[model samples]
Target chain A: MFYVPVSSSGGDTVNTGAAITPAQYVQHHLEHLTLNLRTFRVGDLQEAQGFWVLNLDTFLVSLILGIGLVVFLRFVAVRMREVPGGLQNFVEIMVGFVDKSISEVYHGKSKLLAPMSLIIFMWVFLMNAMDLLPVDLLWRILDLFGVTYFKNVPTADPNVTFAMSLAVFFLIIFYNIKIKKFHLAKEMLTVPFGGYLFPLNLVFRLIEECVKPLSLALRLFGNMFAGELVFILIALLPWWGQGLPGGIWAIFHILVITLQAFIFMMLTVVYLSMAHDTH
Target chain B: MGINATLIGQFITFAILVWFTMKYVWPPITQAMHDREKKIAAGLEAAERSKRELEMAERKAMSIIRDAKQQATHIIDEASRHSVLLVEEAKQQAKEEGARMIELAQHEISREVTQAKEVLKTQLATLVVAGAEKVIQRHLDASAHMALLDELVAEI
Candidate 1:
């Protein structure tokens, strides 16, 4: 439902409930436009939408954005010359940055890590930037097209965050196993205490290994979710009142999104480093 | 709100992105960046080398110019000295020619005066013979007196 913004500046609208209840508005905003996995149809059949459900909004947004990112980087990649120009200079700045970060952390000779970090940072930054959009804008536009329950920000969705984290998690496990070989298992048993406490060490190591993806996912999901929530709540404010708090939150959220993306990339590189080095 | 099949889709999307990045995006851009870095380093090195060469060339040009200036000054001084020596030689030749002309004229004048004096001596002996003949009131023999005249001339 499209919202009619505040007309009177003197009073509050959340309590007044003009077109719909604020609770309903907030709930409607939070819901994702989902595709039922079992039926393989994009519908709002709430009954069977359980664990078999897919958030189509999340999937499509992430996919399109992911492709967009690839195309963008590829565009820069192909157009790169010995002498850089306008767009080339800008993209190269980012490329140089990610390259340096990768070099700093992961000393191993792998080409994918910088690109991977570039994708994560830029794509996540873009996804998280959706929170900065007027929360009702996409929904209102898409609602006009008979689509409802759209959550625009992909990073706000736990699935997307988890997907990225899972990838990083797999990389960490892969490199640890690939590089350390038998030594990883040995360290897993005997690092903290002694070899006599191998059982306790194993349990501790398993928990620690499980926590990496969980922390990365939840940290990103939590920040973006909160940012999205704050924007929605700000949109709930009287239109005249929304400007100040909304602008401030957005200004602050820019830092959050960027920092979150950077942190995700940084942690991934660090994990890669840990997996790479013997220590 | 809940974990579901979206994770699989996202993971699939994630996988595609990772593949695309690794295949197309990462390696080429990384290579381009590395290539650009090497190019820049090479360009700088070339620039530095050319700069050194330019400096050396400039120093050499300056020295050449200085040497040319020195040679020019030396040539100018040599020309002036030669001109001065030529002027002195012309003056010395003019003075020697004037002295020789004056000596030739003086010698001719002295020789002419001696010849005139010898004529006067001969005339004076003839006059003395006439006067003696008149005083003795008799004619003297000229042929006999010729030898006397010659002797007198010698004495004179």
Candidate 2:
């Protein structure tokens, strides 16, 4: 193992480097705090190791943010006033934005859509917003607690993204079954290519159904992952030179983060609305 | 990074969050927003209703004043007509009384003149009879002229 040394202001020494090279730094930042659940190993870092592994960092971070969202919204709900101010006002604007988005897309009446969209937008946004925090600061803090691998943004992780998209996937199936009933099967077999080409129609219909969630998951994961990569790359530069590019990227990234969350939510509404529509 | 248990874990978390939000968070806030909207609408409707009522009341007051003015004019017209009728009746009574007084004065003068004429006639007859008796006694034989003097007295 190689190590780098740091000179303290008190003339003391601290070995701060877990990685000796720039490539290792990026790898280290990219790594997730994982657990191989099949073997029951908590801090497994080996790339080609386990069949059943859990990205504990992604799980924990997303869970905490999700809970934080629920708690904060609960607080706002409990103390909701006719004349809102502060956090309540901010939360209301977020809720209202999600409501407006849902109303725009899903014309069918479901009480679930608005709040579900709200959670997806805010939860994903909060997760993506974590990228703005200095990457090394959190790692340095975790280092003191003897934790080596961590990835802060859950949306960057494909598992988390698929998890949310799959939920929307289930909702799509549910609405199709609910609204179309027996006709859903008939439409799947006959509609686009016609009854004569049932096999081709089935293939195309399956592809269409699968594409909804796949695109949703991939779009969010790709954007956030790329953003995290850029931040890690910026972190590779010397401490003094990192500020300009980092600041500029962080500013531009605000739009990306918000836009990606919005896209994910909007797609969810569109998919569900399609499910509700008759052929 | 790849497929893992975190997928299921996140799905669970997502479910929990959605459930929690739907149960506790969504209903009350949405209810409050809708309630506020209904309140505003009701308030506006009430304001409109009151405004219409006020206009109707004002119109009613104006009409009432108009009716009162019309009634007052009618009463004034009736009173003036009654006063004119009373004046005409007084003038007619005065004219009738003047005519009656003139007729009574004419009747009294006619009665007085008739009475005076009858007294004058009786006095003239007596004087004529006395003058005839003196002339007869002086100029002729008394027995022969007696019969003619009696006849003339009878004629007178």
Candidate 3:
């Protein structure tokens, strides 16, 4: 569920031939600029060493983006006015929209969900917006710093997607345990089946509960990864020919990014709402 | 790519982000909006109150004007009636004064005639006495016959 196989290796132009093939290009783009926490050095286009290793690119991009957006939102929130203007107005509209969407799907009143959804929507959308930049842009820049491998889109990384989804999953479990208490145990044993099939019900409940986060993560990762992949593939085309299809995909991808962010938020709300509900 | 500490790192970042948002970002905008809504409602209510007060003041002013106009007309009628009564009283006093003066004049004229007639009669008596004296060719003492002459004058 969490593995992304390194499709190709030696992605740093070690080819005996002149120009790198398309496959190597895609592989190079997919590689993570990993930091081997044990070895105290960054990876050089190699496989991640062990569980202790961190994908510095994915972590930093997400952390920076997350903190940046949050900081900006908090900045705007600090300066909020009754008659909003500029960024304040935009932020209000966005926050109001998120609040409304959450209220619509999540009938329960939890303080955490609305803000969580807001950040999730905004942060994921920003991460997805990274796809719109030239596929080689950040790599070329980070490469100039002598960094070998980097994946710019954090959501394209399963670890980032799963990390966010698992956070929501933990919240779901926490709320289910907190609010439902003993009834949660009974329901998990008896749901979607009679008491005679309580074991089956438990298994089904486990699968069902696990699937929420699984689908949430995979859906976003799949869309963003495929999108990033296509852009990489489009970059494979001759420079003059790439514009038409690239432009089309980028335009269409605007919708995809927004919709993915929105869907991620909505599903989180729904899942948490389900967790909160007695059923 | 595989699961590693990046998931934990991202999880921490996501947690802190959501935490920061819940703490710092959410309340103020909504609060500002709520405060604005309350202010707008208050403004509308104040306008409504002022309009109502204005209507009432206008109505009161109109009523006061009506009352003052009626009072003014009432005073005008009273003033005219009082002046007419004063003129009639003055005319009546003038007529009575003229009649009194005429009556006073008649009394004075009669008194004067009576006094003149008595003086003539006395003068005639004195002349008659003087003629009688001359015809009789007697010279009586005029002073001695005073009583008889007075009586004769009186009779005349």
Candidate 4:
């Protein structure tokens, strides 16, 4: 079952806009390009889909956001002075903050942690911050080119979110395997907590590993998706009435975007720090 | 409802972007940060060296000034000493010259006095002689009378 918001219904204020039911609008926004060409699976992964499945919109926005971040950082880095000025100062402050956090977590392995954490923080922050942009802005821009179905926030997509989380997860698992070796995995599984508690420990370990990606993906996806929905809902209001609430929400969302990005970045560093440690 | 095809495209785009960023963009950016730090350190070191050099030069200049003052004082002292010695030598030579001039004047005065005395004596003798000659002449007249006087004396 899908949840539909009340704002989407009877909210078409523009004369040029076509009338859309709440379900239609939400479905239109939620739909993704999938691998299953013959059988369309909603959330089931058992049905092995086609090989060339792709989410064109997700790729575009992710590429753009990533490139934008890279360029922006490069610009800042190029212009950075020991005595920083303007945006360079801001970038330095951010780098300093991240470096300090990394030092706190993996003080010994900061050589690896610093750069990794910085990229994760900056790249993901930019992705999350993209949600703050008016949802309709990109749609309107793309609508000119006859492309109507587009979601601006790449992090909202489970696939993209899961991919980022999985990258971290793999790194954790890889480090564990590399550090503990494969022999330890067998021992960890065979070790007895007591009599029947052995299975419990294994289950707990599995759950713990599973939860990393789920939580990482879900947290970012849920937040950005919710933020996007709020923007959509706000846009539905009459233009004159929309201005006040939209302006206020936008103002408030600036903090939300920056904070969420910072939190994601911090968590990423923390997770990586955890990965470098022996469980 | 059909799924949007663009979502997959965006995902691909984002993945490539992220990968490229990690590969290319990050290295140079980090390098740039390090390079900037090095430049700042170098600049600071250079400034410090320059300041130290300036201080050294100032000290050297002060030392030279001190040495010049000492030399100037020594020269003045030597000049004063030579002047004093010259004055003493001149005084001794002047005293000797004055003594020699006084002795020569005394000797000349004595000689003149002796000559004057001798000449006066000679003049006295000449006057006496002249008187005697005159008397003799008067007596010759008396010679005739003398014969008569002699005969008278003989008869006495």
TM-score of chain B of each: 0.62, 0.57, 0.70, 0.60
Model 3 RMSD to the real structure?
A: 5.9
For all the predictions, what are the DockQ values? 0.56, 0.52, 0.60, 0.15
CA lDDT, every model vs. true structure: 0.82, 0.84, 0.85, 0.64
| Residues B1-156, model 2: lDDT tens digits | 687778889999999999999889988777777777798899999999999999999999999999999999999999999999999999999999989988988898888888776676566566655665576657657677778767765664
Candidate numbers, best lDDT first, in rank order: 3, 2, 1, 4
Listed in order, each prediction's TM-score against the native is 0.82, 0.77, 0.80, 0.71
Say which candidate scores most in TM-score. Answer: 1
Taking the tens digit of each residue's C-alpha lDDT, what string does model 2 give over A1-279? 334232221111223644367766676677787777776655545532554788888999999999999999998899888777898778878888888888887889888888899999999999999988887777677756666667888899999999999999999999999989999999999979899999999999999999989999999999999999999898888879999999999999999999999999999999999999988
Instruction: Tell me each candidate's i-RMS in Å.
Output: 1.1, 1.1, 1.0, 4.7
Best by lDDT: 3
Global local distance difference test of model 1: 0.82
Question: Which candidate leads in DockQ?
Answer: 3
Candidate 4, A43-144: lDDT as tens digits: 222332444445556666677667777778777765655566888767766777876776776744434446556766777777777777776677657656
Q: Which 10-residue window in model 3 chain B sums to the lowest lDDT?
A: B135-144
lDDT of 1 by residue, B13-128 (tens): 88888788889877777688888889889999999999999999999999999999999999999999999999999989888988988898889888988987788766777776
- The 10 consecutive residues of candidate 3 chain A with the worst lDDT sum are A1-10
Residues B1-156 of candidate 3 have per-residue lDDT tens digits of: 878888888888899898988888877766776788799999999999999999999999999999999999999999999999999999999999989999999999999999999898878877978866774456466666666766876778
List pairs with backbone clashes in candidate 3. Answer: none
Off by over 4 Å in 1: A1-20, B68-155
